[model samples]
Structures are given as structure tokens and as C-alpha cells.
Target: MSYGKKEFRKRLLILTVLISLSFLVLLGRLWVLEIIQGEKYLFLARNNSIRLLPSRAPRGIIYDRKGEILARSRPSFSITIYPWNLSQEDLAETVKEISPIIGVKEERIYQTIEESQSPFNNIPLKEDVDLKTATKILERKLSLAGVDLQVQPRRYYPDEELLAPVLGYLGEIDKDQLQALRGRGYRLGDRVGRDGVERVYDEYLKGEDGGWQIRVNNRGQRVGTMGHKEPLPGNDLVLTIDRQLQQVAWDSLKGRPGAIVVLDPNNGEILSLVSAPAYDPNLFAGSLSQEKWLSLKGDPLHPLTNRAIQGEYPPGSAFKVITTIAALERGIASRDKSFFCSGTFPFKDRVFKCWKEEGCGTLNLKEAIIHSCNVYFYQLGLETGVDNIVDFSKEFGLGKASGIDLVEEKKGLLPHRRWRKESLSRKWFDGDTINLSIGQGYLLVTPLQMANLIGAIANGGRLYRPYLVKRIISPEGETIRETRPRLIKEVILKKKNLDLLRESLFGVVNEKGPSGRRTGTGWRAKIEGIEVAGKTGTAENPLGEDHAWFIGFAPYREPKIALAILVEHGGMGGKAAAPIAKRIFEAYFNSKVGEKKSRKVEE
Candidate 1:
């Protein structure tokens, strides 16, 4: 009887200990569920019942110096899908139902969903969808689980083709770009600047994005709005471009394949920048079609290229100004020194023929420039030597970028003896010097560089860095950033030399022949009231016809506008390029006159 009582008490003690331990285990699990792991589970539960949709902030508006709208954003609808909210079977069915309505293939929608970074994140299946299609998608929202009709801001370019190259275009962020920009809050399907001013100021132009959390039912339909955050619009950009002047420059091109750049000689502000054969930037506002993209990429004219900053061509006789400066500065030649051209210059084993086969008789520096005489420059090049010419050219910002605000500015080739030896493994010959003297045979320059070079001369040798943007304004109308005129360098040249060159250029447009008719090659560029000084060039091309060129500054006494014009395969500079310059000058002066009269009337 004593042993049985002892055994029963031991059993009761063991059972009591087991029950207490079970209570402790339950309490530990309750602490973990309500404390340590509670927030994570709560978030998961909320996420499953509620959808968080991101709202893209409207991009900054782009305006010209005159406050004319260039680019803005408009409300547009897009079809988006959340992969995590729906089961695999439901997601496939949703894509099938909406793909046909939105005119997108079901396979493409499935691929986009599969390639999305996270199931919780919304992937844009089709952007910039029309109202009719969006309405249809919403009407069947009950059946299409996890599919959302989202209103997004779409980029709009008002100036269209007139400012295509300058304004650039927007494109969706791809996988490669996402890796670099993900930390910056850039998500997949986000539109970013692809080129031009848009690209240069992307950070300032992109606004802060917001998000919305809304309650949803078990059927994947939004039931009630829970929370919302308004998006902040981006800052505004005011460019130095004048829309009127830009139009004039574009009109001057007239479907030609070339570029024209105009600058404010006083401040280095880009007044007009036009690259011909331009396309409408609005074509890229939405999802660009593969066929349209291929057409643009494959077009022979390459209308998309910003030729003003990228096209490198031989400056031809327009480069004679540099040669003349080098010759005079090096004391190899004087303004009064005369060269006799008997139609052709005889050198070792070959004869370099002048453009005028009949030969221009004895001519001095000033007269040679006015007549565009090749033989005169040929002799000057030979006397100046290649090294001296290269040195002088570098001082004028040649063989390097002009440091403009735009990207992809090509540093044109300025070949010297060392470069020839290193690049071609050949000895520099006297013939090479002669070719270099006339602005041919490996010497190349972009239209922007040539314009800046001429602008320096027009502004008394002060080279200013070319700029496009004038100021950036915030949404509160506060100036965030303003660009000031930046002086790049002052070209070292005697006042007398610059004056003499300036006078000779004036005669190039104003001088008349013995018959009282204009004889200068660039006489066609002469404005009636404005004293214009200019140079003309006919660049030789092995592939096709000669490229025509003209570089000039208007109102000779107080130069304001400086221009560089190029016409690819457009024949002589005087006949083709100079006329375009003349039209631009006329339009500019006439507009100034009109403005002055209007101001007087207001007074």
C-alpha cells in the first residue's frame, strides 16, 4: 500500500510538470506572434488585401527664352498589372482578357509580368492607352483580377520637329538602365530623357513620385480608398533659345541635309540651333513602335543626328581665316605681301591648280580673301608651316571640343607632323602643309566649333563657352539655378591684325567690281542696312558633291549675331550657303526693327 501511493504521487508530479511546460511554450509562441514577428506578418496581411499603386510625378515644363512652351506633360491612361495580387492561373486569365482589348498580344503581357522585378510591383503592360480601351478594361475589371487602369503623365512636345534635336525625346528605362538608376527611385517603365537638353538636365526635370494605398476585396477589385499622397511636379527649365530665330534657322535649311548654328556674340547664348531632316519628338512620347524605330535608325539621311554639334566636315576656305592669322602672326606673310597666281602652282612632281583655271593675277592678302583665291592661301600655308598652323588653330578652339552645353560635341581633327607620324606612320610632306593651309586633307570642324571661333573674332577675341539653358525655376516660382556667361579663353591676336581681318571680311560682302557690280564671293550675303562680314567655303568630298559653308557675323560695327551654315553636297558656298545666311540676316534685322517700332508705340 505504501509503494502504490509513492508511485501515484510521482505520476501526478510528472503530469503537473508537463502541463506547466506546455503553458510556457504557448506563451513563448504568443510573444513571437504578437511582438517579434508581428509587424512582418501584419504587413503581409495588409499587402494581400490592399494594393499600393505608385503615381509618377509630372515632369518639368520646358520653355523658350520668350516663355513659349516647348515641352509639357499631359494626363494619359496606361494598363498595369500586379503579379503578386493574383495566382498564376488568375494572372494568365487576366492577361488574356485584357490583352485583346488593349490590342497587345497575350504573350507579350505574360513576358512583361514574368520579367518584372517583384510580384508586388506594378508592371506597365501598355502605356499611353486611349480612353476607349481603358474604359473597356475597367468595364471588365471584375473578371480581370490584379489588372489596374492607372492614369500616368505622358510627355508632350508642342514645338514638334522644329525643336526635336534640341528638346530631344523621352524613353522607358530598360533593364540595363534600371540597375544604375534603381537607387534613385527610378522604376521599370519610367520615362527618362534620351538626349539634348532633356538629357543634360534629367535630375532637375524628374519630379518626386508618390504612392497610394487602397483597400481591395478578395475578388481583386478595389473596394475603398485608404490613403493617398499627391505627387510633386518637377522644376521648370527656361532655355536661351528664341523660337522665332529657331524657326528662321530651320526654315533656311529647307529640307537640306546639314546644320546651322547661331549665337549671341556678346554672351555666348545659343539663339538658334537647327539640324535638317529633323523628325517630330512627339513620336517618342509613348511606346515607340519597332517598325518606326527601325525606320528612323535605318534612314540614310540620319535625321536624328544633331549635326550642329556632331557633324565634322572640312571647313574648306572658311578655314582660310585661321591660316591668314597664323601667317601674319608668325611673320611669314604681311597684309601687303602679294602672291602671283598664274592659274596653277608648280610644286615637286605635281601642279596644284587654282579653283579659277584662268588664274587671278597679282593679289594681296585682303584681295585674296575677298575673291576666295586658292593660290594665295596655298602660298601662305607653305610659308606658315604645319606646326605653326596647328598651334594657331588650337588657340581658336580647333582640334578640341568647344565645351558647349550639348553632349557628343566632336573634337575635329587638327593634324600635325607628330600626329601624321603616329597615326599613319608616314612622314609629313610639304604637300600635306599645302592641303592643311586650304582647310582640306584631314582638317575637320563641327559647325558649332566654327561658329564659336567666328564669335570670338566678332567679340574681339573673347571665346565664351556656348550654353543652351538660361535658368531653372522651381514649382514655387523660385530660381534654383541660373547660368551666367562663361568666358572660355581670350585668343591672343594683335588688335591691328583683327581689325585688318575684319575689314577684309567686310569687303568680302560689300566690295564692288569695276563694272559697279558686286565681285566678292560672299556678296550674296550682304544685307542692305546691316554691315555683314563673312567667309565662304566649298569643301571637296570624295563620296559626292562639294559641301558648301559660310561663317559670318552681322552688323559689323557692333556685332550681335554670329552664324555658321553648312550645306552638304550643296555646291559653292557663295551660291548655296551664302544665300541662306542672307535670308537669316534679313529675318533677324527685320524682326529687330519690328520690335523697336513696337516698343516705341508702347512708349
Candidate 2:
């Protein structure tokens, strides 16, 4: 019994020490919580009690070459409400009151009210409301308890109709865009470029979007900004596209349905590209009213497409340039060789007719081109064979895209024995070659491609990759990168060969006979002292009448500009298309050398 009592006393003493040590450890932990780790826990606890959200950053602005605002962001006042917070009666009452002020019906508000869930705050449906409505709602704050007023940036285009297709426009974020941008930092409600240059330079123009850690009270009112990261503005672009020239081209084709492309012959910078009957872009950005949207949508003229790059047409006689060069290279014809034209050339089964009955008799290469003799090219195609012409045509960037930065550019039809068998499932024949020789049948090309072809000839057989963006200006206004002049291809031809070709082309403007248009067909195109060299075309189409075409260059010795004009159902190139090119040339020279106000380009 004595030993048991002694054991119990010893155990009791150990238990007392153990309890005292545990108490000391607990006190130390308490001290650490109150001192060393206090701030972190305090923040965490405060976060639990308060609701936090994110606010998107401001979007960047766009400027034209002359620092004129093309696209800009303006502060928009929007009203929002937490649909989950209100009772059915309160929600119905709120909807009724909001309907009269916002011009929204009670049905829409009720639908919005029912669609919301209670726990997660549902986003409100209102956007771009005025400040006056918001002020009135704030005065009646009790009636609009869960409502929110947000100031956000909305995009604006100054010259909405002038550059609708090229400048493009922006729109609210879509589901597909959100899915694609999963790891790319885009969020809901962000504005994205939909088309045109806006789509092309999106990365440089979007800038870095930042966010704010906003703390809100129980009623959804903002208490304070917990954290924020300021956004960086997007870089500006300085395009080779001249605003004045663009306007001139746009105004020139106001009522006419045609396409025009003016390019710098030195480098492939596009000075102006105009497709007539364009729709205003401002109609797209807003909540387009039914009547206003219908006004443009119902029009027969497809104002949406960019015809300069998209429209395809046969080159007609203008394509003779290809045939002439091919003939020279294939040893089928020499510069001094002459072909007798009795108004036409009869092939295996087809008769290709010339413009006049007298035709051109025993005409040399210069006269052949000047008169645009179908007999000359037709016989040449038969002599050199189709394979050689196809090979040479591809060399000049035909039957392919010119690699312009526009979207959906079609690689034109370049026909050969192999291409015919694969695409049409038919055997190649002599008849096919004859048509292809004269730039008909399966041969198709865009105006842009033809313009680049002209540029290649003007710059001594070096093809340049045509482009519009001259340079990209950084946020700090420094040039990020400059576009270098590129020699895409050097056509296998001697300088003398190129010169000989130029001389004949010059005769088209200076000489008489079939190529003579200055007398009547295109009398109005003549300008004083400019020395313009050009070719006219009339391409026949199964869908409609012939597509009128004119391609030319000026200051003949030192070529400066190259352009192509196509007027759908418009008459002969010499009569219709050539005059437009002449007018555009007149405008350019008038503005630059003449030191006078540029004249309006005429069709």
C-alpha cells in the first residue's frame, strides 16, 4: 500500500509538468499569431468578410498616317443591377421603374430577373446608358439598391464610311473568341477587332490589358480598390495608305460600280484601293435599329466585300503582255518578226477575231502590241505551245496570289496541261492553249496581281511584295520595324528586252490603228506633259458582259505608279477604264509636282 501511494504521487507530479509545458507552447503560438503572422491573417479574414471583383482596363486607340483619329475609345456610362438580390415583387417594381427610364419593356426586365441565380451575382443586361439616367437612378438610390453604374471605354471610328472595309471594326467578346483566348489573357466583355487591318495587327493593337482588385460592400457598392495594375496602350501604325488619296479614290467611284488600285511602282506600296458602293461601318458597332440596318443590308451592291483583292477577272487584251514576253523567251518570235492579220487568226477549230477588219498586216512586235493584235498572240500561243506560256505566266506571279496582306486572297487560275487534267478532268487540247494564250478560258487574275505585274515591268523585271503598312510606330512613337523593298523575282529577261517591251507599250498611248483610243474610245484621259504608257482590256464573262480593264504607268522612262481599274459591264478598256487611270495619274501629279489641289479622278 505504501509503494502504490508513492507511484501515484510520482505520476501526478509528471502530469503537472506536462500540462504546464503544453500551456507554455500554446501561449507561444498565440503570441506568434498576435505579432509575427498578424497582418496576413488579418487580410485573409477581411477578404472572407468582403466580396472582391475585377474591372477591365481601357482599350487602345488607332490613328491614321497623319495622326488623325481613326478609332478611339470614349468613356461610356452603363447601369447594371444584381438580379439575384431582389425579391419577385421588388424585382417587378424595379423593372417597371427602370423600363420607363431606359425605354426597355417590363417583359425584358422580368426575363432578366428570372434568369439570374441567387448565390453567384448575375451580370446585368444594360450597356452604354447616358450619365443623366445614372444620375437620376442614384438620386432614387433606395429604389435601385442593387444597381451598379460602370464607366467603361467604347470604340469609335471617325471616318466610318470612308474606310469601313479596310479599317474594319471592333465588337464585344464572343464565346468562340473566349475559348480560343483561354491562355492568351482575354476576358469577358473585351472588345476584339473583327476584320480588315484591325484583324491583321490585333496583337500590336490590343496592348496589355490590366485589372483592378475591387472590394465591394454587401449591397455591391465599391468600398475601395484593394489592388490594381495599370494597362499599356497599344502601338500606333503608320500605313503607306494616303488618307487624301484614299478619299480621292473613294469619291471618284461614288456612283459607279468599279474597283481601283493605285500602287507605287518603285516598291509595292498601295497608295489607294477603292471598291465602290461601300457600306458605313458605324452601322455595325452599335445596336443597329431594324430600319437602319435594313437600309444597308437590302442594297443589291455587295458593299461588304473588298473587291481590289477579291474580285477576279480575265485580263483580256491586257494579258497580251504575258503572251508577248512568253513568245520572246520561247524563241517562237523575235522583236522584228511580223504577223499578217486579216482581221482574225483561225486555230485548229476556233477563230479568234481582232478589233478591226483591216487588222494589222505584217506588223512587227512594237506594232503588234500597239494595235493589240489578237492574231499576233494567237499564232504565238500555237507556235510556242501552252506549257511554255504557263511556265512564263507563273514566273510573272500570275495564277497565284501576289501575297498581299489582305484576307481570303484567291490564287488565280493558271491553266496548263497538268492543271487542266487535274481540275477539269478533261484532256488538254490545242483549243485550250489557244484561249489561254489570249488570256481567256481558264485564265483568271485579280487587279492586285495585275498591278504587281505592271510594277514588276516598271522596275526592270523585279517583282515587289505589295503592302500597305509602311512601318509600325511603338507606344513611345519609335519605329518598331520598317518594311524593306524586296525583289521577289527577277524575270529571265535582258534590260534591252524590258526596254523593247516598254517602247511598244508606250506606242499604245502614242501610236494609231487598233490601239488608238485617244481619238475617241478614251479621249478624255489625255493629260499634258506626263507621258503615260498604258494598255486597255475587255474581258468577256459568261455571268454578264465584259469587264472593262485599264493598266498603266506614267513618266515612261522613270516609271512611278502602276494601277488597274475594272468596271463591271463597263465598255472597252480604252474607252472606259483608261480614262480612270489617266484621271488618277492626273490627281497624283497635280498634288505632287503641279503643286495644285488634286483633281477628282473620273471614270
Candidate 3:
């Protein structure tokens, strides 16, 4: 019994020592954490309760030259997930719970989470959510952990389709863009400009994004902001476009499958540019559905195409202006030299017939221009030769991109001896020259190039590099940059020849032909009080009706505005395209009168 009691005492002593040592160790750990390392752990605990939420800065406001708002950002709600705060199973449950409320599929949400490079970063689950849906998410905040509601900026175009082609639309940054721009602070799912000026000036328009350190309760509800960095709004853009004139030009198209470009002849400032079959840019403000995207992609009219710069079509009779320039400058045809048009001109094996089968008899250079005599030009083209024709054409900015500050600018086909040899492995023929002289046979020009061409003629042969943006203003209203008139080249036409050409173009609009029974080809473009000088063109398309073209400058002598109008498959330039020019001219002159009257009243 004594031995057993001794053994039990020994065991009890061992238990007491072990227990005492454990208590001592616990006391030392508590002291260290409460005193020496207290601030560090406290900061860590506070950080666990604090969440960093991104505050999207609104993109710059786009304004017309008249101070009219074209595009701006509006506040919208978005839901995001903090991956670090949730495990895989937790995320699945949270996604499933919020899927029906946000109208996003569980699979998509999971895929988004999976694509995230870091668990510490926030993943966007749904963007641009409605107020009703956002309220639902907030109401279920207690049940939905790691999900956050944020207010972000959504791009909006008040004019919608009226300026879609120029203003463009925004879309999420793709893999390639993200990879290229990641170092520049661009992240996945960032809204980037997909086309138009948006793409061109994205660097200026996009602002610095800011964020807030928000404190949340156990239920994932916001308590207070620990700290925040205020978002800096993007710079503002002032375009050279005149909203009133832009509206007039757009209205003139009237849903036709064509384009219209209006510019200041003295400068390269684009006043109004319109492409028909426009789509609403507002459709892209939110997450575009597959159905909507497919519909836009599948449309036959291709509403997304900016016809002003992208659509390449034969200039039709517009090429006559270039041919006339080549003829007079190269000494191939004199102003008084008359050519007899016998309704058709036979070249080698092929015969080319004029539009007027009866014929334009004994027409001089000026007379032929007014009449748009195809036979007269056919003879002139052969004499001037294709080389000189191509040279003069390039000098006038044809067969190449205009270097306009827009994307997708196509360099129109400028066929020559080398191009013929290399592209078709064929020799140049007289038939080809006859066709080229009349703006037919593989000759293509964009509407922008035509506008630039006419602007050069109006401004006395000085070709200016066409520009759209007039000024870029900072958010604080300071001018960051301003655009000046940039002269590309001068055609250096003879004063006498230029004067006669101008007069002939004036006659094309204002004067009747030698045959009083018929007016000039551009007669329909005549305004009551304004003297307009322009030429008309009919591009023959074997596939369909001929494309109509009319390029002109208004106020004849002291030209202010120049226009290039194209009506695809619209039979005649005078009938289809010239009338549109008349309306646009009337609108511009009327607006100018109204502005003067308003200024007088102010004075």
C-alpha cells in the first residue's frame, strides 16, 4: 500500500509540472502578442475587416464644336467578388445564390473566377446591373459572402446612331489587348474603345481609376470607409464637328446605303461625317448579348462599316475633274481645243459609248466638263497617257489613304503600268486607258478622299491632312492640345487654268449646256442665292445599278464648305447625289444666317 501511494504521488507531481509549464508558455505568448507584437497583429486584424473596392473613373466627355455633348459616362452598379475572402466551395455557393438575382449563369461566374490571375484581386461577376437587381443583392448581403456592390461609370451616347461611326463603342479588354496593355495599368475586363475616335484617342479619354478601403461587418455589409483615393475624371474632347450640320448631313442620307462628308475647305477640319445603316452605340454600353452581336455581324448592310473612310467605290464622273486637271496641266488638251463626241469612241477591238447616245458635238475643255462628255475624256485620257493620269491622280490624293486621323482608312486602287504588270501580269491597253479616264475599270476612291480632293480644289490646290478632333481639354477646363490646319501638299495648278476650271465647275452647277434643252450634269445642285461649283459622276457597276457621286464646294468664289456625297447603286449623280448636296448647302447657309442674326441681337 505504501509503494502504491508513492507511485501515485510521483505521477501527480509529473502532471503538476507539465500543467505549470503549459500555463507559463501560454502567459509568455499572451505577453508577446499583447505588448511587443500587438500593433502588428492589430493591423492585420483590421486589414482583414477592411476591403479595397475599386471606384471606376468616368471617361472624358466628348463634345461637339458647339459645346453639345456627344458622349458621357453615367453612374451604374456592378457586382464583384473578392476571391481571397472565399474558398472554392464558398464561391460556388455564393455564385449560385446570386446567379438568378443578377441574371448571370453560374458557369459563367465560375469561369470568370477561374480566369482571375490572383485570389487577392477582385473578379467582376456582373457589370451595369439595374437598381432593382442591385437592391436584391444588397438585401441578401448577409447570405452572400465575398460579393460586393460597386458604382461604376457606363459609357452613354445621347445621339446614339447619329454619331456611332465617329464616336465608336467600348468593349471589354481581350486577352491580346490585356497582355499588351497590362503593364500600362490595363486589366482584364477593362472597357476599351473598339473603333472610331474612341480607339484613336483612348489614351487621352481614359482616366486614372481610384479606390476606397471600405470596412465591412461580419455580414459583408459596408460599415465605413477607412480611407479612399478619389477618382480622377478623364479629359474632355472637343470635336471639329458641327452638330447642326452633322444632323443635316445625316438627315440628307435618309437611310440610303451611302456616306456624306463635309469639311472646311480652308482647313482639313471635318464638320460632318455620316455613314448610313448606322447601329445604336448604346447597345454596346452594357454587356452585349450573343444574339445582338450575331445580329450586327450577320446584317447584310454592314452597319458597322464607316463608309466615309472604309467604303471604296468607283468615283464615277468625279474622276473627270482629275482628268481635266491632268489634261490642262500636262498640255495634253487646251481650254479652247474642241473635241467632237460622236456618242461612242472605238478603241482597238472594244467600243466605248457615251451616256448621251446622241452625242455631245464640238465641245471644248470647259464645255466638256459641264457636259461630262465621256468620249471627250476618252480622247483626252489617251493623249495624256495612263502614266501622267496616275501621277496627277496621286498628286490629288487619290489611290491612297488620306492619312486622316481615323482607323480602317483604305488606300484606293491606283492602277498604273507597274501595278498592271505585277498584279495582273498583263500589259496596259488603250481600252484600259479609256475606261480609267472615265473613272471606271478597277478605279476606286473613298468618300473621304473625294472630300479632301474637292477641299483642295476649293482652297486653291492646297491639300490639307483631314482632321476630326479640334481640341482636347482637361477635366479642369484647361486646354491640353489644339489642332491646327496641316497642309499636306499643293497641286500648283496654273492660275489661268485654275480660273477656267473653277468657272467651268461653276457652270456645271449654275449654267446650262450648249444644248439649252439639257442642263449641266450638276444642275440639280444649284442653290437659289449660293453659287456652288461641283461635278457629278455615275460609276457603272456591272453587278448592279451605277453608283452616283457628286463632289462640290459652296459660295463658288470664296468657298467655305466642301462635300462628297455617294449614293451606292443610285443611277445618276445629279438625280440622287446632287439633290442631297443642295439640301445640306441650304441647311448650312440658313444656319449661318441664323447665327449672324443671333450675334446681332446679342450686340
Winner on TM-score between 1 and 3 is 1
Residue-wise C-alpha lDDT for candidate 1, range 1-603, written one tens digit per residue: 999999999999999999999999999999999899898668667787887888999999999998999999999998887766567788778877887898889888878777776656778888888889988988898898877899988899977899887889988887898899899878776889988988889889999988799887755778788899999999999999989988988888788899999999999999899998888888998878999999998999998898999999999999999998888888877779899998999999979878889999999999999998999988989988999999989998999998887777899899999899999999999999999898999999999999998898898988998999999999999999999999988888888888888988888889999999998899999988789999999999989999999999989989999999999999899999999999989988998899899999999
Give the Cα RMSD of candidate 2: 9.0
TM-scores of the models, in the order given: 0.91, 0.82, 0.89
lDDT of each: 0.89, 0.74, 0.89
RMSD, each candidate, Å?
A: 5.4, 9.0, 6.1
lDDT of 3 by residue, 1-603 (tens): 999999999999999999999999999999999999898667556656787887888999999999999999999898988755455677678878998998878888878888776455567788888899999988988878788888999999999899888899999888999889898878766788999888899889989899999887644457788899989888899999998898988988788899999999898999999999889988998789899999999999999999999999999889988888888898877889888999999877888999999999999989898989999999999998998889889999998888888888998898988889999999998888988999999899999999999888888999999998999999999999999998899889998878888898998898864676447899888889999999999999888999999999999989999999999888999899999999999999998999999999999
Compared with the true structure, what per-residue lDDT tens digits does model 2 show for residues 1-603? 999999999999999999999999999999999899797667555643254333444444555555566676667767767654345676666777778887778787667656644334435557677878878777776676456676666666777667766677766667898899857877665677776777777767777765566665544455577777666777776666766777777776646777888899898888887777676666555555679757766777777767777877788888888887888876777788877999977765767787767777787887777777778777778888888888878888988888776677777788788878888899899877778877888888888888888877777888888886767777787988777777678886866677878877777776655664443233345578887777778888897778888777887888888888888778677877877777788888876764333333331
Tell me how many clashing residue pairs each candidate has. 0, 1, 1
Report the Cα lDDT for residue 404, model 2: 74
Compute the lDDT for candidate 3: 0.89
The CA-based lDDT of model 2 is what? Answer: 0.74
Using TM-score as the yardstick, the better of models 2 and 3 is 3
Q: By summed lDDT, which 10 consecutive residues of candidate 1 come out lowest? A: 113-122
- Runs in model 1 lying further than 4 Å from the true structure: 1-44, 174-183
Best by TM-score: 1
